[model samples]
Target: MIKHIVMWKLKNPGDAAKFKAQLDSCKGLVPGMREFEAAVRTEGLEANVDVVLVSAFDDRAALQAYLEHPVHVEVSGVLGGLRESRTVLDYET
Candidate 1:
């Protein structure tokens, strides 16, 4: 299995919830996606980023499909415009 994790630091922290919503919209958008989750950091948490997305895929090919999927491309385009920075990790699990 493959795990895909991403964290975003938004230009406006207030948009964290909105960003999480956008990320949530991607749920079930592709096959071979095992799990999809999005979350915003708690108000008092020691988080370096505002929003985070965690996803699991059946395999490396599945992860690649998710990245190239058109729905993801569009959503990511919008999300990309709102974030100051992004960190991503994809690895076998």
Candidate 2:
């Protein structure tokens, strides 16, 4: 399986909910999506980023399909406008 993790620091921290919601919208968007989770940092958490997404795919091809899906592309555009910095990691597990 492929593990995909993304952390984002928003241009405006107040928009974290919107950012998370946009990501959540992509759940079950593509075939071979094993898992999908999006979360906002807790109020008292010690973290550098504002939001996170942890997902798993059956393989590299499935991960690629998710990345290229139209719904994902649209959601990414929304996320792009809201984020100041973004970090991503993808590796086989």
Q: Can you tell me which runs of candidate 1 are displaced by over 4 Å?
A: none
lDDT of 2 by residue, 1-43 (tens): 9999999999999999988988999999988999999999998
Q: 14 in model 1: Cα distance from truth in Å?
A: 0.5
Candidate 2 backbone collisions, by pair: none
Clashes by residue pair, model 1: none
lDDT of 1 by residue, 11-76 (tens): 999999899888998898878999999999998869999998999999988888889989899999
RMSD of 1: 0.7
Per-model TM-score on C-alpha atoms: 0.96, 0.98
Residue 85: error of model 1 in Å?
Answer: 0.3
> How far off is residue 58 in model 1, in Å?
0.2
Q: Tell me the whole-model lDDT of each prediction, alpha carbons only.
A: 0.92, 0.95
